[model samples]
Structure formats: C-alpha cells, structure tokens
Target: MSVHHSVSTHHHGGSGAGWLALFLVLSLLLLGLVVAIATAIGDYAIGLDTVFLAVTNGLGLTGADISPIEQSVVWDLRLSRALVAALSGAGLAICGAILQALLRNPLAEPFVLGVSAGASTGAVCVIVLGIGGGGLSLSMGAFTGAFSAFALVAILSNGATSGPNHTILAGVAAAQLFNALTSYIVTTSGNAQQARDVMFWLLGSFGGVRWPDFHLLIIVVVLGLGVCLYMARALDAFTFGDEDAAALGVPVARIRLVLFALTAMITATIVSMVGAIGFVGLVVPHAARYVVGPMHLRLLPASAAIGAVFMVLADIASRVIVSQQTVPIGVVTALVGVPFFALILYRSRPQT
Candidate 1:
C-alpha cells in the first residue's frame, strides 16, 4: 500500500508537470503573436511580413528588403517598446506573486510595499531639481528612491518580527510620505512642461522606451525570475504560515527580508524605466492563480507569461485607442484592473 501510494503520487506529479509545460508553451506562443501584432499595427502600419523581415535582417539572418524608414520604425521603435512592455509586465507580475506568497495575503502586490511611491519621489526630485543631469538621471533617481523606501519599510517592519501586518503598515506609511513628497515637488518646484512630463510618467507611458531600456529591463527580469524560482519551495512552505515555514527549516524572517528586498529591486527597476505602471503586479497573479492553481513553481511562470501578453496587448491598445493620441499605459491597466478588482472583492464576500 505504501509503494502504491508513492507510485501514485509520482504519477500525479508527472501529470501536473506535463500540464504546466504545455500551458507555458501555449502562453509563450500567445505572447509572440501579441508582439508580432503590436509591431505590425501601429499608426504607420508595417505589415507582419515586413516586421518579420526587419527582425531577421537586424539579426543578420536575412538580407533587408524593407526600406530604411520602415526598418527603423519596426526594429528601432515598436520592437523596443514591445520588448520593454513584456519584460516590465513579467517582472511586475513575478514580484506580485512573490509578495502575495511571502505575505500570505491575496491583496499583496508590488505597490503595496511602497516601491512605486518611492520611485516616483526619486524621479520627481530628479526632474524638478535637475539633480541627476540627463535623461538617465531620472531612472537613477527613481532606483535610489525605490531602494530607500524599501529600506525604510524593512527597518520599520522590524525584520518580519510581528508579521506581514507590520510590513504592510510600514509600506503604507512609506507610500503616504513619498507620495506627499512627490506632490510637493511637482507643485512647488516643477515648471509647467516638467509638471506635464512628470504627470505623464506618474500615469506610466511606454512611448519613449528604447533599446537601452529594453536591455536593462530584460536583464533585471531574467535575474529576478531566477531568484524567485530558486526560492519557490520556501514560498510554498510559507503558504501554511510562518510557524510551518520555520518548522520546514526555512528561515522565516531572513527569507521574508530577502524576498521583499528582491521584489522591491525588481519593481523599482521597472518603475524607473516605465514609470509606476500599476495593476500588472496586482491583477496578473490572481488571474494566473485561477489558471494555474497555487503552487509557486507553476504560479510564478504562469503569472509572468500572462503578464507579458497582457502588457503587450495593453500597449497596442494604448496606441490605437484614440486617433493620433496615446493613452498612458497606467491608465489602460487601471481600466482593465478596476473591473478585476471589483470581481475579486465580489467573490471574496461570504456567500449566504
């Protein structure tokens, strides 16, 4: 009976692994399709074939048949934006999944930890005061701000002593303080144009993303995913509670501190590149959980894939939603996220 039970458990695990592999492949294909479509359907529409050719030529896999202008539009502009969108989305979603698992809270996300607000404050300082020096300065400032906020939260949370509640409270305090700082900077020091730019950034826009941003984002997202996956077992143990995790030989306090800091870094990197694009981290994990169940190993990859697809589609929508005017990516995410948030709330209520 013992042998039979072991065999059955192994068989079940194999089947689950197979299903997850299939789901991941399908999600990746969907993401590719979205990227292709996004590249082909902008204002100056490049055909799908042309986009492919441009990509191949850029890779030196084929000779260029497309015009220089079309090549530039496809390879230089749209592809960079799509890649950034996908990377940022994947990073944010993974952060959300980790935070939720770490905190054991369904509502936990990257922003709940005050990283975005801190980033915004840092960016505001750069833009309003001209501290950093150039375009890259804003990103540098935001990164600094994000880390600073996380540091404050860690200190106030007392290194996971009381519980996630303490961490959440610390995050809330940090967010409010940073947000006020951002507002004060914008109101007091920023010129009209700077204010307008800062507002657009606060709302999030992918319009200005370039290859440099894409390169940095891809590196960060890949590293973050690797770190999260390595800690997947710890995250799974956390689902049972801190006591259970400690019993399982996981250093509950240390692990929590590490995961929170890692997530904060990933969130800050993405926020610095694209501004504080909300809701991807908050909503994508829940959607992925519904599709893939609650195992962190499966949940993390599923969330990342879904998030990448969602953000690319959102970017396309932001571009085409209005004639000749781009909507902020944050606004697009909010419009989609609010309905999901409502649904989550509705479902969470006790059914009589």
Candidate 2:
C-alpha cells in the first residue's frame, strides 16, 4: 500500500510539472503575438507589411530601406520605448521574486517595501538639487537612492541575522522615512516647475523613455537578469527558511548578501530609467506563482515574462485610454493592481 501511494504521488508531481511547462510555452507564444499586434496599434498606424519591412530593415536584414516616416516611427521612437518597457518590467519582476524569497513574504513587493520610495527619493534629489546628472542623471539618482535604502535596511536588520523579522520591519520604516523625505523636498522646493515634475515622477511613467535609453536598458536588464538566474537555486533554498537551508549547506548568510545586493542593483537600474512603475514586481510574481507553483527556479523567469507582457499591455492601454490625452502607464497598473492586491489579501485571510 505504501509503495503504491508513493508511485501515485510521483505521477501527480510529474503531471503537474508537465502542465506548468506547457503553460509557460503558451504564455511565451502569447507574448510574441501581443508584440506583433502592439507594433501596429500606436498612433499613425502602419500596416503589417510596412511594419515587417521596417523591422527587417531596421534589424539590418537584407531588405530595402524603409520610408523616412516608417523608419523614424519604428526604429527611432516605438521600438526603443517598447523595449524599455519590457526590460523594466522584467527587471522589477525579477527583483520582486528575490525579495519575496529572502523575506518569505508573499505580500513583499518592490514598492510596498520602500524600494520605489527610495528610488524616487534619489531621482528627486538629482533633479531638484540641480546635480548636473548630464544625460543619465535620472537613473543615477534612482540607483543611489535605492542602494542607500538597501544599505540602511541591511544595517538595521543585520541581513538574515535576525532573519525575516528585522528585514521586513526595516523595509517598512525606511520606506515611510524616504517617502516623507520626498514629500518634504517637493514642499520645500523654491522651484515650482521642478516641484511639479518631481511630483509626476512619484506617480511613475514610461513617457520619459526615448531612443537614447535603449542601450542602457538592454545592458542592465540582461546583466541583472543573468545574475539573478544564476542565483535562483540558492534563492529557492531561502524559501525553506535560513535554518533548514543552512542545514542543507546552502551558505545562507553569503547567499543573502549576494541576492539582496544584486536585487537592489537590478531594481535601482530599472527605477533609474523607468521611474518606478509599480505592480509588475508585486502583482505579477503572485500571478506567476499561481500558474507555476512556488518554485523559485520556474517562478523567477515566469514572473519576468509575465511582467514584460503586463507592462507592454499597460503601456498600450495608457496610449489609448484618452484618445487626444495620454495617461501614464503607472496609473493604468495602479488602477488594476490595487484591487487585485485587495483580493489577494482577503483570500489570504485565515478563517477561524
């Protein structure tokens, strides 16, 4: 009887894994379809043939040069912005996954734990302080703020020494403190115009991205994602708690430092460029978990992919929501994310 039950359980697990792989492959195919459709829907619509021509030419395939308007639209404007959205989405989602594992909190999201607040602070510091950040000033400000917040939290929590408790508490405190700092800066600013711009950033947007940012976006997203993928198995060990993981000889403390630092850098990199788009990190990971179970190896990549799709779709919505007027992508995500979050919280409630 025991042997029969064990065999049955193995079959169940194997079947579940197979389903997850199928779901992931289907999701990837869907994303490709969305991208193909998206390139056709923006303002000044281009036909699929023209889009293909532009794409082939822009990619430097053996093709005739595109007309100037198509070339400018496809290569100079749309593709770069789309790429930026996708990369930022993927980065934020990856950061959320690691933070969730480290803290062991399903509610652990990048913005909620004060990462966005920190990055917002850094960005405002540069823009408001007249720091002469040159072309890359925005991202630099965001990265600096994000790293500072992580450092402060690390010092307070002692990084897994007090385990999850101190880390979460510190995150809460740092987030509030930094948000207050941002508000104070805006209120105290003598420059009214600068104050308004900073206020807009607090809300987040993809409108700021342009052709010039693509290189930086690609570099950070690729490097940060590669490193995170390398560390996924270790992050999985963390899900079982530091003690059990340590018993398994997983170098718990060392892994904590490496992951925390790497996640922060990735979050900062995205925040610096994309201006703190929310919900991708927080909501998308849970959505992926629902589809793929809680295994970090599968969860991290799936979250990144879902996140990319979510942001791309959100950006499209932002563009079309107001025909003559444009809404920010951040607003669209928040509108959708807050309610979904409430549902999660309500369902997660323990019944007496």
Candidate 3:
C-alpha cells in the first residue's frame, strides 16, 4: 500500500511540470518558425544564409559580408515589421487572456472594452485637427483617448457590480461614439490623400513601421508580460467568480481594477503604434486555452507565443496574397478570426 501511494504521488507531482515544459518547448518552436518566415519572405527575397549574416553582423557577433541593399531590406524593413508584429501580437493576447479571466467571460478581448476605438479617435484627431504634432505626438493622443474610453466604461459598469453583460454594453456605446467622432474628423477636415492614409491606419497597417516603433513596442510587451505573470495567481482566483475569489482572500475589487487598467494601457500603446489590429486578442487566447487549459500561469505565456506566431503569419499573408498591394493586417485577422469566433460560440452554447 505504501509503495503504490508513493508511485501515485510522484506521478501527480510531475504532471504539472511536464505540461509546463511542453508549452515552453512549443512556444520556442513557434518563435523560431516566425523568425525564419519573416526573414525569408519579402519582395527582395534574401536567402536564409544572408539573412542570418545580416542579423549576426548587426548584433556584432561576426563580420559577415553582405550588400548594403540586402542589409537595408532585411535589417530596416522586414525585421522591424516582423518584430513589431510579434510584440504587438503577444501584448494583445496577454491582455485578452487577463480580461477574459477577470471578467469571467470567455468572449472578453482587448478591444471589446472600447480601447481600440478610443485609440483610433485619438490618432485621427492628431492627424486631422493637428491636436498634437506628428510621430510621438500621435502616440500620446491615442494613449490618452484609450484611457478616456476605459474610464467611461468603468463608470457605466458601476465598478465591481457591473458584471460582464453591463461592461460589454458600456463598451459598445463608447466604441460607437468614438468611431463616429473619428469618421467626422477624417471626412470633414482632411483632404482625399489624408483621408486615405487615415482609413488605412484605422483598418490597421504595418507598412510604415520602423526600428523606432519596434523599440517602443518591445518595451511595452515585455513590461506587460511581466505584470501579467506577476498577477497570474490573482488571475486564476478570478476564474472562480467573485465570491469564490473573495473567499480566497483575493481582494477581488482592487485586483480587477488594476488588471483592467493594465490591459487598457497595453492595448492603447499597441493601437497608437499599429493602428488597431483586430481579432488577435479575441482569437489567440481562446486557441491557447484550448491547447493549454485555463490556468493563467501556463495560459498567459502560451497565448503570447501563439499570438506572436499568428500575427507574423498574417503579416506575411498580407504581403504575398496580392502581388502588388498589401492587404490590411486587420482584414486578414478578421477573416481568420470570424471562423474561430463562430466555433467558440457554437461550443459555448447551452445544450437542451
């Protein structure tokens, strides 16, 4: 009896560790896949060898011979966009996972709380009304707008008592209001060319992302991931509903507010940089949950990794799907997301 008990205890002890190791391995492999694909598939089409040489030389690892043009294309254009996509995807996915858990709603996503709409409105204001200067100024505007929308949602939802349905309704109202404001600014004030530019941004495009943008995105994603991981235990508590969480001494109200603010900040930062890429936060978390289950500790990192892979692949498809022109990243994400959304809905529907 003692030997049997020992064997069973040992097996149980290793199971969690085993699953975690598997997730980490899978995430690394996905990261590798995205890096390879992003480096290799572009207009100029640099070989894998040249791509590595350019990267290593840039990193001061080794002095490898490569042409200036190839170096510029790989280092400046392709690599920057790829890095931004990965970082943005990871940030969005983490936000979604946190939101879904906190709200106790599987459908909760980063933008569902109206952050993206607010960010878009802010960016449009900068572009059309000249509220702020170009570049950094636009980012600031978007950030401000995002938080403002979230503030409204919080008020309407009535803090901890609001529930998921109330929050979603409040979000919808905020989104419509901001979206309309964005349309008015673009149409009434801007010229045709400016309007076109704004439209592209509103729909999401990474065509103009540079090294500077990548730097900011990397900082935000790394910090957001750290914060989420730190709150992983609290997040798991939230999955069990407010009463249960409070019973566990989780301080449900304070923690929910903090997580909401963090998600808003992360979402706004990405939207300011990349023009509101959609469906990533909604779809990636669900897929990650399906693969890794609902525990936030394992779920957060897995979702980030899967989200990064999804965005990188989407960006690649946007570039190649049409020979001369690039499809908006948001459109690609939506096309992919709708199917997943349907499946989730179907699975979640109550049976007779």
lDDT of 3 by residue, 115-137 (tens): 89999999889888888556548
Q: How many clashing pairs in candidate 2?
A: 1
Best by lDDT: 1
| Model 2 stretches astray by more than 4 angstroms | 1-21, 133-136
Question: Where in model 3 is the C-alpha error above 4 Å?
Answer: 1-13, 133-136
User: Model 2 lDDT vs. the true structure?
Assistant: 0.77
Q: What would the per-residue lDDT of candidate 1 be over residues 158-199, giving only the tens digit for each residue? A: 867768777888999999999999999999998999999999
Residue 179 C-alpha lDDT in model 3:
92
Better of 1 and 2 by lDDT: 1
lDDT of each: 0.89, 0.77, 0.85
Worst 10 residues of 1 by lDDT: 2-11
Best by TM-score: 1
Off by more than 4 A, model 1: 1-12, 134-136
Candidate achieving higher TM-score, 1 or 2: 1
What TM-score quantifies how close candidate 1 is to the native fold? 0.95
Order of candidate numbers by TM-score, starting with the best: 1, 3, 2
Q: What's the C-alpha lDDT at position 178 in model 3?
A: 93
